[model samples]
Structures are given as structure tokens and as C-alpha cells.
Target: RGMNAYERLTSYWPSYDSISPEARRAYLQWLSSGRKAPHANIGYVFLFFYGLERRVFVDAKTDQAAAGDIPIIIAEVERLLSIYGKNNSFNNYASRFVDFLRQGQILARRYQKAPPAPLPYGYEMPVELRIGLGQLAADKQPMPADWALAWVLSDHNVGKRTPVTRCKEAFAQLFCMRYEERYGAGMVLPQNKTRLRLQYNTASAGLPPQELDGLSGIPDVTATSAARKKLQQLVDECTVQLEPYSRYLGRNPDTPDALEGLLQLPVNLWPPTARTALAELKQRIGDGMVVMSFGELAGRLQSAGSLSREKVLTLARALESLHIGIEPDVLTGSRTPKSEDNVALFATQADDGDLRSSPAYSAASVTLDLACAVAAADGDTSPQEIMLLSQHIDSWSHLSGAHRKRLKAHLRLQLNQPPTLQSLKMKLEPLAEPAKRVVAAFLAHLAQVDGEVSPAEVKLLERVYKTLQLDPQSLYSDLHVASSGSSVGSSQTTPSIPGASPSKPVGGFALDQERIAQLQRETEQVSALLAQVFVDDKPAEPDDVVVEETVEDTSSICGLDADHSAFLRVLVSRTEWSHDELEAVASDMELMLDGALEQINDMAFEHFDMPVTEGEDPFEVNPDIMDKLPL
Candidate 1:
């Protein structure tokens, strides 16, 4: 009555209480007597339970036991298990062990998916990766190392594309965009994607298009008030000269070959002696080779027309710079057909001793010369302008050593090319239509040198525009909006060139103190911004600098020898010193101080050589305190 159902299950004698006295005695007998009765199913279950309960053997104890002994041991375990039944047997142990192993596996998977902590909020991420080893080995010059970093951020595959093709595409896009940014979109005449693809294909094949009308345009680089004023002046001057020339030519009605008056003007002016010298040189060197010589070339032009030696020399320099095959010889024989044809485009002679004009000229040289003249007129040259000029010069068709030398000399002298048809046409080209406008705008400022554009200067401008493969009028817009302070082909808002002074005029104009100060502030801000972008901005050290200094001991000390100090100095100087010049010097002093401290320690410690008794130890407390104390 006192024990409930739970208590009955917990109690050990539940069977003895419920069953008959005989059954209870039998259960007690079964527990006390361990007997082996071999039945196949019982024996199998008992042996399986025994094997399941076996501990992992560390030694060879189980291997030597008899086979019959194993069955007997299993039977004895089963007899004990029969009393306990299924509840307290091998099943409980197996279930608990399985549960523990399964729980561990679950934990291993859960920890694997957790995200790492984000970097601190203020830290800047590095933008560039190290260039590949292959690229470094193959590189001939120090390529702009920063270019790769800038490139990756602005133009790389975000997801699907490969890095190489993406880089190339990005670069192409940037090149075109840069042009549009500096010049107007109209300047390039960019069409639809299909048209651009076709154009790109044609360019790739080296097959240039037939003559098209260029979009007349000015660049954002010329957005300043000074630049506008200069451009207006150029337009006015060119209009004055060209308007008259176009009228005159329209009235004359002369055939291309039969301009009798024109022929006589140049022929009568030729110097026979120089012409003869040129003819001899041309014969000896062949027209191809003689065309490269400036002296011979100048004489050839004199033979063609009434050019002064100086004017002839100027033309010769321009022509040779273009790499055209022409000689001043009057003789017609031995001139190969190819040479004859090439010279015909640059020819100024009809039959003999006559000025015959051709359609071609050195457009690039003339344009550069005009720009240089404008820059010189500015009074103070800027680094931006100088860099642009350098880039412009680099784009020209490569010339020979002698020709380049002469051309540079001419530029240095600030000499103008004459206003002949050939010289004028040489100032223009189809591919560089926007460049022509740049040159023309600059030419306006050039007249500022003397205060006005002359008839000769106007004529030079007209001839240059006329020579371009594309029609120049198409590119230079007729819209002259004086109030808007802009023209048709120019951008409404002009962007300044990088590293250029935005406040200063793009055209050659003087700035006041206020403007100069503004430019300085802007430049400083830009420098700071650039510093933030760069990873390593340290100034390079001089290659031949002494990074370390040796300090000699010239002091008298207690028992320290001169040789020991000298040895210490050598040891200090020999250690690697990697720091700025000032810091390195300080570091060397600290190292020398450290050595002196060590020397002092040695003199007090090991060098003193104090004798010690066998039983004595320095750190032990004295046990003779009782002896020292008063009794």
C-alpha cells in the first residue's frame, strides 16, 4: 500500500511480492547459481551481448582464453541479464553512445558556415594587386605601376567576364571617353554602336575611310574667357584673308597647269647657281635620298619659283619633316615613276622654272609651329601646356635624324613657315581635325605677339584648313554665340585638364594675383587627394648615401682600454641601419650608448673576478642572523 507503480518498478523484489513462493525461490536460485544451458538462440543472444559489452583490449589477455571458457563466461552474463530482462542490458549502453557521437557531428557542421568579422570602419582597403612575375620580367621600362590599380577599380569584370578581355574593353572605352571629355562628342562624330564597331574594324584593318566632312569643333580645354577671346580673334583674322583670297581665285579663272602669270612669278625669282648645285646633289644621291637633305631641298624650291633663300629653307624644313620624296632638280631623267608621283603632290614647278601648286603639305608641322607660337606669346609657359605640346609632337610621323634636328632648330628659333599653298595645306589633316581647331585657336593668340593677326598669318590658317583629308568647315561650327560665351561645336561646360590650373585661362592670357592664388589652392587640394590615393608616397633616397655613422671613444675612463671601445664602435657601425638620414644618425647614437652600458656592466661583473667560497650562494638569506644578534 505504501509503494506506488513507480516505486514498484524501482523496488528490487517486485517479482517476489507478486508471484508464488515457488517462483520467487526459482528467481533467487537463478541469480545465485550461474549455470550454462546451451540453446542455439539463447547462446547466440548471450554471446552477442557478451561481445557487445567487451572492453577494447590493450594487451593479449583475451587471445589466450579457451573457446569453451568464452561460452561459459557469456552464459554466466546471460543468467544475470535474465533477471534484469531487457531494461538493464546492452541496449541502454548502445543507445547512449550513439546519441553522443551524433551530437558531435551536428556541432562540427554548425560552426563551419559562420561569417568572419568585418574590418574596422575607418581602415582603407588596398586598391592594387602586385603585378604578375611574367609581366615584371618582360617589362622593358617602368610602366605606370598605379595604372593597374586605377584600371581594376574603374574597368574590370564584375562577375562573368575574364579579366584580360574586360581590361582591354575598359581601356578602349576610357580612351574614347577621355577624348569626349577634353574635346566635345561632336569632334569625334561618334555614331551608333554598329557604326563604331565598323569604324573600329576598319581601323584595325588599317583601311581608313574615304573623305568625310569633319564636325567643326573646339575643345573644353579652351573654355576660359581668355581662350574664347583668342579664338574670336583668329576667326576674324582668317576670315579677312581667306575671304579675299577666295574672291580673287574665283575671279581669275585660271587652269591648273596653265597659270602663265603664276608660273613666271616663281621662275624669274630662282637663283641659277643654287639650283644647279641642288640638281647635281639630286643626281648623285638619287631623288629619294636628296629629298632628305634640307640644304638641297631649299635650293630645289628656289629653282621652282621666286622664293627667297630664307623662305625656301623654311619650306624645305617643313617638307623634309613630312618625309616626302622631292629634289630641286630641273632634270627630268632618272627620276623613278614613284618618286615623280610623290614629288608631284608636293610639286611647285610646271614643266620647268614655274610655280605649280599641289594639294598636299605637312599639316602636322605647321599646326605644331602655330601652337608653339601661341604658347610663346603667353609670356609664361605652364607645365600642362608643355606636356600637351610634348604629346602632340610625339604623335607626328617619325622623321630622320637630320630632319628632326632642323625642325627642332626652327621651332627653337620661333620661325614661322611661309604662307604658300603647300605650307598652308601642311597645317591640316583628316584624322586630326580637332587638333586643327586647337592650332587655329592658338594662332589667334599668336597675333597677340605683335597685337594683331596679319594677312600672312590668315593665309597660313586658311591653307592649313584646306589641306585636311576631311572638309574642315564641317568640323568648325558656324554658330558664334557671343553671349553664351560658347560656339556650336564646344561643350556648354568645359572640364579642365588634370594637373592644370582651372582658374587660369586656357588661351594665353595674363592672370591677376587673385586668380593665381585660387589656382594654388586648387592645386594643393588636388595634391592631397592624390596622396590619399597612392599606397606608398615616400620620397626616394639618394643612391650613394652613407646610412650609418661610426662613433669613436675619445674619453678617459676607469680601466676601460682604447682597443675595447674601438671594437665596440666597429660592432655598432656594422649593424644594419634602415631609416631616414636623421633617424639613422640618432639610432646609431642609441646603439653606441647601449654598448657603453654593456662595457660598464662587464667591468663591474665578470671582469672584477671576485672569489667565492664553495658553500656560498649570492641569492640565499644568511643563516648567521642569531650570531650577529646581541645575546
Candidate 2:
């Protein structure tokens, strides 16, 4: 029977491991002479050979032994293909050879394990082959010197070993070929040991090494050790140069553990050009060209506002290293300053006389002063009071943790020397108009923090209102207090100035002399009645006659005469009396008077020849009221 395709292929190509050396040599000779074979069968032979070569190349210990043989195989294949002309058979073999070389170059780079021996002598290489090997070595995947030497020795009947000097020369030639391929062809190889050492050291460092023109002789053991030490010294110098930058950046360079932690951080955590910029900044600061503290510099960086205690301590160390003076109380080595000294320092810093020029600073200072004053207004500072004050400050300002801590310290110091009302007012006077309003509202809020505004707190708030030059009614309105009268048990009120009107006109009506006197009497009566109401749990109801008299008195005080007063009295008598019954009756009477006033206004407008719309009735005509009129 005829052989099948698999059998035919296997017959022509025995397993590579099973092939005898003589048979392989004879086959290569015939292939080089252009003897045609089945293209598929020849391809299978080349593939099997490449697989065997791959195994030998990948084994580190034996790879150097086989490296010398690769070039011979490549050269023989090239000779065969040149004679055979272009065809699938030659193409397949050529492709496999190229693939093998590529993989070997990659393995050389990945391992970076060059053999101790160099290339052997007396093997002439084609310019194309030299250029290919040069390109591979220059691609950062250095071709192993011993590997190239072995390849050069492949076709020759040389001994197992070669002279190291001759090998070095061959390796140098290969490297030069690569260098010429990369740069232009006319450049000479660099022969200076100093330049080579520089390139080597620079490559060992983080930066890309400049290409050296030529290889100097390899150094002996003592020379190599010395070179390594010099390289390490350069590295140390670089680290020392970075010390100022890290210190000014709030990183502790002295602490090895801290530096190691910094190294492990992500790239973006340390911004680009930050070290250089900070170094320049430090130089500027040292020269007195820029005046700023380390803390202020760190405050401008990202994630610096929320620094941890450890980081804060590290920042202190860094600042010390830079010789940038920090306030003794602001930060010291790992621990916070002593409480008393810290408080004193904070108070002094915050209360500097120059704060008057800065509205925000003055406002903060006055706020702390007022808080201390209010806290002690009722004789002592309670924990609840301190807590309430803290919350108020937090809500009012966007203060960092360090600033807040300093403020707390200042507050404690202020409690020792609470300012008088006049002093506090003077301090607060520099605040802007909007800030003054905020302070007024804050004081009012603070007064009611204990769930009830105390008499002392009310008195303090009143003083503040006047001191701040704010309207008392507006202050009370902001506090949501009842505007009709002062709060119970408190003496706060809109006090009348000496030359000012005794009574502010209500509803745009001027009070005559009698009406003014009557209004004063009624105000006193209301105050007395309110005091009574608060004293008794349930106030006793006044008799009808007394209620009628009170209603008539209030009406006349409000500028209404006898007829209108009688109408109000009738309205009050019809409603059941309560503690605030007088107030309710007064409200109703005011509404009725408003309508009557409107009718009078319309009639006056008509008299003045102003047209009035037909459907618009300014007043409701009450027949019962009209009939009761004296006219």
C-alpha cells in the first residue's frame, strides 16, 4: 500500500533527538547545494530543529554552550536558501530562523545573565548578520557577549575554549556595530574609562543612561568595587539634595521609616516638579525674599488641611530641618505645647492690636471675647455653654482643625480676663456691617442656649445691641421674641433716647399731647397686667365694667374718640374675657379703625378732585354703626 501523508512526512524527517550527527551534517550539505525536497517535509524538519534549539536556549546553564552553534545553523540555512531561489520551502525555513532569533533576544533581556566568556576569533561575519545582531543588542535587550562569541566559533573547528582577550575584541566589534547602526556610521568608539563609568553609573541610577561610544576594558575586582562605592555616594548626594524639598513639603527626611513610607506612596501623591519648586521656595524663604511659615505652605497643598497627628508631628520635624521658625506654641516636636503656655500664646497672637485692620481677624477675636463674656455672664462657665459656643463658631466659620484648636485655647485664656461691655463693644466696632449683624444674631442665639434667656443674658444682649449700633426691635425680631412686649422676667426693651420721641408713632398717625399721655398710662397698665399674668398660674378675670373701662382707655389712647370707643367696648363685652382678651379686642378695634380710616382717605381724595373707581368701596358701610353715631 502507498504511504499516507503523515507517514511520508515522518519518514523524511526523523525526530531531531534521534538523528545522528553525520546524517545531520550530510543533510545540511545537500540542502546548501540546492537539492529540492518536499516543501512540507522540509518545513517540518526546520520546525523540529527550532524547537530543540529553543529548549537549549532557555536553559540558563547550557544556553551559553549552545549559543555558539546558532550562528552556524543560521549561516548554513542562508547558504541553502540562496542557492534554492525563493519558494515556500525556503520561505518557511527563513521565517522559523527569524522567529527563533527574536525569541532568543527577548530571553537575553529578561534574564540579563551574560556568560563570563567573550567571542572567539577567526570567524568572519556578513555585514547584514552583524547589523542584525547589533540592532538586537541596542534594543535594550543586550546580546550576551558569550552567546555572540559561541555563534562566531560555530562554523570553525576551534577548541572548546578561546582566549578572553580575543573574545573581548570580538564583543567590542559587535557592540560598535550596534552603536554605528543606532547613530551615524562615521563616529569613533568612546575610549575614556571616565565616560564609560559615568554612563554605567547614570544607568544604575533612575535616569536613562547616555550611550557610550566605546567600551573600555572591563574593570578588575577592586576597580569594580570602587566604582560601585562611588555610584552609591552619588546616590547619597542626590538624597541629601532632596532633604530640603521634603522638609519644606512637610515630610520628615530624618526619619528613615517615614521616608520609606513616602517611597511606597503612589506617584500622583507626590506631584511632578513639586520637589524642585519646594526647593526653590525654601531658597527664597532662606534669602528673605518670601516670608511664610511651613504651616502656611502646607496649608496650600491637597490633603494637608486634614493632616493626621503623626503627619503633623512629621511636619514639625521637617520645619525644624528647614530652619523655618515656627511659633513655640503652634507646634513643637511630637507633643502639643503645655496647656498654660499654649493658651497664653494663642490669646496674645489672636488679640494683637493689628487685628483691627483685618475685619475677619477682628471678628474672630471679638467672637471669642463675647463668647467668654456670655459664658461667665451668669456667674460661671458651664460645660453646656462651652459646647454651645463651639457649635455656634463651627457653624459660623470654616476653620481648620489647627485654627479651631487655637481658638479653643484662646477662649480658655479669655475666660480668665473677661472684657467689660464697653471694651467688648470697642473690639467689635471694627467688624463690617454684615459681620456686626451676624454677631448680634449670634449673641441672641447664645442667650437662649439654656432653653431660656436669663435676666443677665437679656441684659447682656441689650447692651450688645446698643453697643453694636443695631436697632433693638430688629434684634428682637431676629431672635423671634414677641415684639408686643419684652420677654418675661427680663428688663430688655427698646430704651428711648433723651431727645428722641417718647413714643414711636403707630400706623403712621401722630399722637397729640393728650393721646401721648394716655398712651403712656395704658402702657404702664399693660405692663402691670402682664406682670400679674406671669405671677399667677391662671389670672383672675376682670369684671365686665372694668373690662369696658380698659377697652375705652385703650381706644382713646389709640386716637379714637367716644363713639368709636363705645363700639370697641361693646365688642369687648360680647367676647368671653381671658388674660389676653384686651389684646384680642384691641386687634379687632384696630381693623375696624383701618376700614374707617380708608373711607376717610377716599373721601379726602374725592375732595381733592382725584377720580375713584365705581366698584371700589374703601369702607364697609355698617348701618348699625351709622345709627349709633351721635350725628
Candidate 3:
């Protein structure tokens, strides 16, 4: 029993003095094996955790190991949690330990010191993640995916008492889509070199002896007085933007006005000198400046004659930090190619942009939507392919830069959002004749770009063909009549799809002269129409409405049985409850505590589409059903 680790454990807390002698031997044996067991006694793990906590908050900080040892500490903590995380006591402490590490990173940033490390995506809760990623202040417009991601990761009630978490996989899909689109093309990326910080108060704090409970390796409440989250005014202002995306913590979300609510604006913390710029930017945003082309942005910033180029860029960054995205791409130039215009610099500010107001733009935007549908038709194309598809959209420079912005946004939304027949129906039904032919030919071209037409592509194309009244049978021979009619190199839009590197028909169709001519002609017609019809011919009544459907709460909520349902209602009312309180309630309802809990959680996974309710002793409800409750 007198071993190295047992002695270390006692140094963390005197409570370890009562650990059983048998447990003591197990703990030492576990430590001697490098503490690498996949499973171990919860008590033994806690004893080890006591030492880890000391290393992080006490030893690491006090000994200046916070410089580099924190990463090793985090890795060890994560490894321990991977094994014992199911234990409520262990999971809660470990999860909070990681979160507090994140807090330290944020605090370190504020103190102008280096953060130990960046928290990787999915490493912590969504609330903390959003703040860390600078999403909180990002006056991000509520795109359908954003709303859907928020709704699905949240909790909701199916019936009177049946509460469940919404789909997490859906949230992950949307998150990855957004991340790749913003950061680069891929499922995940390494952390950016942005600064991070966190602080702790030690002067006014009193230290606990080893006899006291094992300290949680967190800073004192005084240091965290503002709760780590209260940084950046704009972040606090647009609370609806990112805060609700908190990762499911087995607890239900706090209730607000489930049925209704009001938005509270963040205070303007910008210094007085740039007040003119802020006012100008606000005015432009209010006046439908949704797609602030680099050209337009330079002119507007220059209107502030007092502000130099550096001052203008600083002002833009300041606005972006507040979540008001404006001209992020254009740095020093007033003139940029139409290709550069597609950046939705003001996407965080405006909901319905004037870009869609133009009949020509709206008519053209639908083309990109269907293109994305075609690209994803097989449901196996990589995001990079879809992005390459955006480059194809980019070649349609005939459409103004503003139009491209809206078009690309549509493509991104379609790629991640749940597909809807109604949106396609609405868009296709209203198209004029020229628009219809161009739309049909565009899909035909995109579908066969891989040389061999996929069944999924053919199937999606058939639907599109029928919708536009293009003859599905004539899909092959109409355009490719003669070899001279090939249009492969005739226009910029014919740039080969990523997989189809060559300009001509690729696979089996590559050698067939008739098929090659057809692909060329198909490319020509599609490009010509895109250049002419998309900009020249405007529909009499263009459907300028953005294609997004409001998903009903009923669609997402998973229902539980009468007993479990009733139990859920009780659980959602409060975040934390003692085991005795939970048991007393279960007994009053004539239900077995363990079975009802398990059954309800099963429904949480099955219907709510997430695994909730991890640990107990102090249950923190995070389901969205609690969203209806006043916070």
C-alpha cells in the first residue's frame, strides 16, 4: 500500500486515506503498467485524476510547465476519459477540465500571452467552440443550414412529456460543410494560428490543503467572474447567432420563450474615430448591401476621406470581429475581376439581399442550385468536386459578381441542407423558355462529364428534363449532330469537371465520335445560354424568394412512452438533481428508476437522434425541449 502513486494520490486529497488497501494495490499496479489499461476501477482513476489535476492547475501553472506540458496533460486526460468517461463523476470532471483548458486559452489571449494549444473542432461544447472560433460576434445571417444545424443539435418535446435531443450527425455534416467552405476543401483542418488566452486570480485566492476535496484544476471564481463567455460585445449582442449551438451535454437546453422571443443588440464598442465608418457600413447594410463587391467596398471606405488604407482595413477587421462580415477578401484594391465578386462579404448582416431582387440574377441562381444537385446526385462526390463545380459557376462571368455570390451561397446550402422537392418545383415552374433550355443543357453536360453517365445523374437529369419540358429522349442527339459542332473549347464554362480532366467526353464516351461531338455541342449551348439568356432574358415575374423551408419541430422530436415521457418532463424542468430526488420521483410514478432512464435515453438516440444523459448524481439537462422554459 505504501507505493509511489498512492503517496501521490494522498498528496492530492486526504480523502484518499480511506481508499481500500486492495484498491491501493490495484492503483499502484495500474500506474506501474503506465496507466494504460482500457478499463480500471473508477476510484483508481479518480486517484490518478487527483494527481493530473494538480499537474494542470497547480503543478503546471506554478512550475511554469503551462508553457508546453499542458498538451501532454490534455492528452493524458483525454486518454483517461476515453476509458472512464462513462462514469458520471469522471465524465463531468474531465469534460469540464477540457472546457476550462479552453477557457484558459481564451483568457490567455486577452492577457496577450500564448495559449497552450488550440482546441480542435468537436473538442469542446458548441457554446465554447463558437466563441473560440470567433463565430459569436460574427453577425452571421441565419442560413437554412445554420438554423437546421441549430435545431437538430438542440432538444425538443415530442408529446407532453417525451423529450429528446435532435440529430447530431446532421449538425456534424453541416458544420464540416461550413468549415471546409470557409477554411479550405476537406472534412477537417488543423487549427489556424489565431491568438487565444485565459486568466486565473491567485492573489486574493486561498489554496486548499491536500486534505480538502481534489480541486477541479480550474481557476478561482473571481478570475472567471465574467464566466469566460462574456468577452466581445458583439458576441454578447447577437446571442441567437451561435450560443444556442451548445453541444448536447445530456441535459436539456434552458427554456426561453419557446413560442416567441426578442433580440437584444450588442453595444457598440468601436472607438469614436471609426464611428463614421461604422455608421457608413451600417447604412449600407441596411440599404440592401448584401453583396458588397470589392469594387463597391473600396469606394465606400474611401468616402471616409479621414480614414487611410490601413485604417479602412482595420475598420473592416474590427467589424468582422463583431460578427459583421464586410469585404473580407478585398484588401487594397477598388477593382477586382468579376470572379472576386462572389464573396458574400456581408452574409452575416443581411438575410434577404438585393442580389436576388434582379430577375436575371434570380433566374441564373437556380442553375447553380440544380448543378449542386447534379454534382451530389450520386451522393458520393467529394466536397472538392462540388467546389470545382463552383468554379464552373464562376466562369459564367456574364452574371454580375453579386449574382455569383448568391449563386455560390445557394450551392453551399444545397450541398449540406436536407434536399427538398418543393424548392426545385418552385424554381423550375417559374423559368422562362431560354432559362429552361440552358438549365436542362447545363445538367446534361454536368451529368456526362465523367464520361460514363451515372444512374443517379441520369435519374436526377430525367427529373430536371421533365421539369423544364426538355425531351428526355432527345438528350443525346440534339446537340452533337456533327463533329464540327463540338463546343468543348468554345467557352470558359466548358472547363472540365475535376474528375474529367480532359476537355472532351471522358470515359466510354471519349472515343465515340458522335458522343464527343454531342458533348462539345452540349457545352456550347449551355455556355452560350449561360452567357446570354441568364443575363439578357428576365422572367416577367421572377421568384426572388430564397429557397428555404421552415422545418417543423414535430419532424425532429422523438417520442417516448407514457412513463418515460412523464419522466422527461420532470427532468427538463431543471438541469441538476440529486440521485435521491430522481429516485423519489421515479418511485412516486411507479416506475423503476434505472429502466425508465435507460428507455428514455434509448429514445433519445433513436428519435432525438443523439446520445444524451451520460452521468448522474448532478444531472444537467441539455435537451431543446427545455428551450420552451424561460431561461
Question: Best candidate per TM-score, number?
Answer: 3
Candidate 3 per-residue lDDT, tens place, 185-301, comes to: 211211222211221211111233221122223221111112121211222232223233222211334422111100111113222433466566666665233554445554443
lDDT of 3: 0.44
Model 1 CA lDDT for position 255? 29
Question: Model 1: which ten-residue window has the lowest total lDDT?
Answer: 194-203
Query: CA lDDT, every prediction?
Result: 0.29, 0.38, 0.44
Model 2, residue 353: distance off in Å is 25
Kindly provide the TM-score of model 1 when superposed on the true structure, using C-alpha atoms.
Answer: 0.17
- Per-residue lDDT tens digits for candidate 2, residues 74-145, read 665555455432444334334334333433422222223433221221122221233333333334344343
Candidate 2 CA-lDDT value: 0.38
lDDT for each residue of candidate 1 in 413-515, tens digit (9 for 90 to 100): 3322222444434223333445444434333322222223334443443444455443434322211211122322343233322122223356654434342
CA RMSD, predictions in order: 38.4, 43.7, 23.4
lDDT of 3 at 463: 74
TM-score of each: 0.17, 0.25, 0.27
